[model samples]
Target: MNVLITGATGLLGREVFRAFQKNEWNLTGTSFRRKSPGLVRVDLSQPDTIHDFLNAHLPAVIVHTAAERHPDVSLRDPAGTRRLNVEATAAIASWAATHGAFVLYLSTDYVFDGTKPPYRPSDKPNPLNDYGRSKLDGEQELLSRAQKSSVILRVPILYGPCETLAESAVTVLADQMNRLTEPTLAIEDWATRYPTYTPDVAYTILQLVEYHLAHPDFHGIVHWSGNEGMTKYGMARVLAGQMGFPVERLVPNPAPPSGATRPKDAHLDCSALEELGIGRRTPFAEAIQAILHPA
Candidate 1:
């Protein structure tokens, strides 16, 4: 099967590319700037370019992991965010539908309002921020346009060794431990999301593709995330404990309201995914250890 993955140079995209490579799948990956072997430089912001590429490639599956994912960045440039996240996604979904190719769109837990915990796939989305709103737009576009051959997988805060945010957290804690000083603050009151190992998410995507191929009638939104939920402070503690870092380096605090308005709780329930036998939540500790000691 020929599979095309967009945003192949980003953290999650790179992991997905590696997984597909290991499986010896006929894969073509795309990036905007950085070029790698088997990668084509395609700008999602250009619908004509994207459409031409899709028509030429005619891939059996299109795994779209690209988007303006940063919440703050999205707030700063909402127009650009919509261009890439919403409009571009709609274009891709339309192209995929035209070609009769299965499209797996990566979504986020941010689609929830955070007023409720452990969001289900059936739950109505009430996005609190620009990033969430844009993603929700993409989800709706894909669902409404490519109803029969689309899968929307909403993920949480992804944590892995290669992930930029995860690595930043590790580096900050390590620096504090080296200095024998405690980190100033951790957002204890802000209950947010769990983390998904990149490889695990990629595996689940592959399973979704396989399921679609076999059933031929399966298509809809699916929730894929870690087994447990934790606050930012709790996740930090887990990282410290698993890495054998000094736990004293963590200081509990509340999220400041001056910055971006994040959902207080966005944990996703994967019961629908579990029913498919494709969503198995990886343990938080194990995921932490893997990040600490990547092989």
Candidate 2:
């Protein structure tokens, strides 16, 4: 099967590519800024380019992972976010619908207001920021166009092997902790987030793809996330122990994180996918230890 993965150079995309590499399927991972030897450089921002590429590849399945992932970044440029996340997705979905190609769109837990915990796939979304809004719009675009052959997998904040500490919001905490200029660093303790492991999400996607192959009628939205919930402060404390950072210097602020109003807690309910026997969760401490102290 010809499988195309967008944002192949990204943290999650890279892991997804790695997961597929273990299989016999023909995989094409797309890249943009951080182009690699194997990845194809395809600008998802260009509709014509997407059409041309889809025509050439004619992939049996497409794992769409490209998007304006950060909330502050999306807030700074709503137009750009919508163009890439929504408009580009609409174009891909339209093309896939006509061509009979299956699409697996990656979405976020941010779509909810965070007022409710463990949000199901059926829950009505009320995004607090532009990033969430854009992702929700992208999901709507895909579902409307290719409801039968598309899947919207919504997940929480992700953390895994990354090029830099800055690649993930969760890993960036270590960078912040290491380069602290002040006497103490205050981390947000108000908002609770599930720092999902990327490798696990990759595995889940692979299983779902196989499941789809077996059951042609399997489509629509599903959720997968890390089981454990922790605040930035909690994560920072754990990293401090592993990296020998000063836990005393790290302060926990029980106030909402400033910039781009976020949900207090947007824990995604993964039961939808769990019931189908498609889920994985690595212990937070163990995963962080492996990442920080890799042999």
Candidate 3:
């Protein structure tokens, strides 16, 4: 089997790359800004190039992890976000459909409007920001274009094995805490996020891919998320204790996040994947410990 992973150098994509390394399949990873020995540099933002690029390889499966994922960044450049998130995704799915390749698109929890506590695969999405809207659009693009078996895996707030502490939304708190010379950050205690582990998600992706190979009929949207829900303040306190930083120094802002409007609680109902026995989740504190205090 030939498998292509976009954004192979990203926080989640890197782990997915590692997970597939032990497999027998012919695997190729794509990187944009960053380059490595095994990574093929490709710009996903250029929709015109995506078709020729994928058609050249025609991988049996494609793990489309590339996207302009930052909420504030998306808001700042809505056109750029849509260019990659929706337009580029459309090109990929269209090519996959014609070539009979299965696509596994990595989506986000921001697709839901925070009013809903737990969203199911069947729920109607009402995204609050440009990032969520673009992702939702990408999901629609994939479903409509990919006539072959495809899966849209919607996950939330990923964190694990980052090159820099500021790489992940979860680990960025540690960076904020590191601003010893500056005023403490007012971390959001308002919105609840399920900080899912990337290695665990990578494992789940491998299981899904293997299961999908046997059952090509397994097509549609599925949710995978951490069972534990916590606010930034809650996560910060955990990190503070782990890092030996004063918990009292961490300021908790009970208000909603300042930029890029977010849902209060877009907690995904991960039963679809969980029911298939194709999921693994590491506890937030436990996983964060490994990243913060790597032995």
TM-score per prediction, in order, is 0.91, 0.98, 0.98
lDDT, candidate 3, 1-295, per-residue tens = 8999999999999999999999999999999999778999999999999989997888999999999999999989999999999999999999999888999999999999989779998899999999999999999999899845789999999999999999999999998898777556678899999999999999999998999998988889899999998999999999999999889888889888788999999999988787789899888889989999999
Where model 3 places Cα greater than 4 Å from the true spot, the runs are 182-184
lDDT (tens digit, per residue) of candidate 1 on 11-32: 7788788777877678899988
Ten residues in a row with the worst lDDT in model 2?
Answer: 42-51
Instruction: Note the clash tally of each candidate.
Output: 0, 0, 0
Task: Give residue 253's lDDT in candidate 1 (0 to 100).
Answer: 75
Residue pairs clashing, model 2: none
Model 3 error, position 9 (Å): 0.9
Once model 2 is optimally superposed onto the true structure by TM-score, how far is the C-alpha of residue 107 displaced, in angstroms? 0.1
TM-score of 2: 0.98
lDDT of 3 at 75: 88
**Candidate 3, position 22, lDDT:** 90
Error of 3 at 234 (Å): 0.2
- After TM-score superposition, the amount by which residue 177's alpha carbon in candidate 3 deviates from its true location, in angstroms, is 0.8
RMSD of 1: 2.4
